[model samples]
Target: MTREEFIAAIAPAAVKLRLEGSPLFPSVRIAQAILETGGVIPAWNNLVGYKVGSGVLTPYWKGRSVNKSTWEVYDGGETRVRADFRAYDSVEDSFRDQDLLFDLERYRRVREAKTPGEQIKALLAGGYATDPDYAKKLDQLTEQYALTRYDKEVDDMLEQLMEQIRLLQEEVRALREQKAMTEIPVWAQEAVQAAAAAGILDTTTGGSYDFYRFVTILHRLGLFDAKGQAG
Candidate 1:
């Protein structure tokens, strides 16, 4: 696939993986996929050139693999070698399976990386690829394509979700306050009963706290006689 086609095919899964709390940044993930496959998407759906290293089969990868010719750098020299690469049914499955690798102890730094650059460094430190210039290549791809925009999109979405949650909390608090205002408090319950008994109050409910206090004070001053009239 061409660069644009490859990005279009993988960007959605990359963004979704990041938004779902994968520590890998969407920009870095997309750049990695581009760099790993050189913008030529493999038919097996292995977007990031994942290998069948001693990893156990999971729901995302069902122990299927393909043998392919790949390049590896060793001792400052590059050579084409045949290797076993894990295959997936879909691009999303490949992305998810790649994320699952981060759960390993060796990839802890990758998980803790907060920035795209930091993630690249962590990936390099963890021996994700044998290429000495892997970080630089990934960086170039990320900058050239403006892939970080996807990361920003995820951030904006999360902020909007948080704002919605805050609004819901405010609404809940307002309802609680309204309920408190309409309910009779223990301090004003006796006055409310007296008013109700004297037929001075149509109902002993739906009054604000201040209104209940005012009625209690008037009752205490004996303003209403037993006939429900002012004394």
Candidate 2:
């Protein structure tokens, strides 16, 4: 299928799932689809990044690889087992499995996102991909494909989540204040002393300060090393 056709077929379901679950999956799915199939659609309808094994003699046989190499199996199964991967009957199955795979616990954070953008951002922040610019690339894809057009219904969802986060932060701050008033633990005193000695914390509030800012101040005083590490 061509990119346009693939989007037409899968984008609706992706939008529906994103609205129901998380927004990030669609972009990741799109990127993976492109990577696995070399387009927004699969060449042989193999949507799940499946690899064929050496034993498969079928015409659709792409290539081969060992299925399970580790020896942790109790039955002492074949050390180099070969297996056939499922080639999907249609593009729909591929899209379906894409959603199903994201539902797995490994992607729980992205799956739980309230919006597609939030989900994509969370995946990047959570280290879903090693690429340092993964989030930016996903955002570019989202805008390029106009994926957010399908997200109009959930436009305010992110705002609501942000408000909820703010309230939780306030509650956490109140709890910490209560804890602080009740005790000045030895560890806390030691931390204060260390901060004062390192000049990285505010002595009055006993709040941990950013070391980079301290380093910048030190650098102005000619104390920073050439590499920006503490001198």
Candidate 3:
């Protein structure tokens, strides 16, 4: 796939993960995929070069692996070696598997980072990549591609979702309060019922608290009675 197509295809998935509470920013995620695969998405769907370490599996990664040659920084030198990298059925699953890695306690700083730059720094400090310039390279990619726009997209979506939730909560509160207002209080129930039976009141529901009390007082004064007669 072309560079733009690759990014277009994965950006939504990355944003979705962020919206679902993945701490990683969409920009950082996209940059990692670009750097990991050199802007060419592999058919195996390992966007972030995650390895099948010790045959451990996550819910997103189903123990499938492919033998690949990868470069690692060792002893102040770059060395090429064959390794087992985790494979996924789709790009979204690959992104999800990466989220599982960041969920680890050791990557707590990555999760707590307030910005993409801070997250990149935390990833480096947490030994995410062995190369000394790994963070710098990712940062360059972030700026060059203006990938941070995806982060803004996620923020906008989250804000809209929160507003919808707030409106729903308000609706529920109003319904509850309205129900409370329409209910006949225990102290006024008998009097209101008497008033209704005598035709002194047309309705027994939806009266304000004060109205109920007034009806009860009239009933107490024998203005309306259980015999369904007006005094």
- Score candidate 3 by TM-score against the native: 0.83
lDDT by residue (tens digit), candidate 3, 21-119: 988899999999999999988889999988887677778888888999999999999999999999899999998888888888989999999999999
Candidate 2: give its CA RMSD in angstroms: 19.3
TM-score of each: 0.84, 0.41, 0.83
- Give the C-alpha miss distance for residue 168 in model 2, angstroms: 37
Q: Which ten contiguous residues of candidate 3 have the minimum total lDDT?
A: 200-209
Q: What is candidate 3's local distance difference test score? A: 0.89
Model-by-model lDDT, in order?
0.87, 0.55, 0.89
Between candidates 1 and 3, the one scoring higher on lDDT is 3
lDDT of 2 by residue, 1-231 (tens): 676676666666555555665434555555545544445553446654544423443433323332422221224432433444545555555455445555657777776776666787776565444455656776776777776665563456666778999999999998886665554454456444444556554555533334334434554565534443334
How far does residue 140 in candidate 2 sit from its true spot (Å)? Answer: 0.7
Output the TM-score of candidate 1.
Answer: 0.84
Order the candidate numbers by TM-score, best to worst.
Answer: 1, 3, 2
Clashing pairs in 3: none
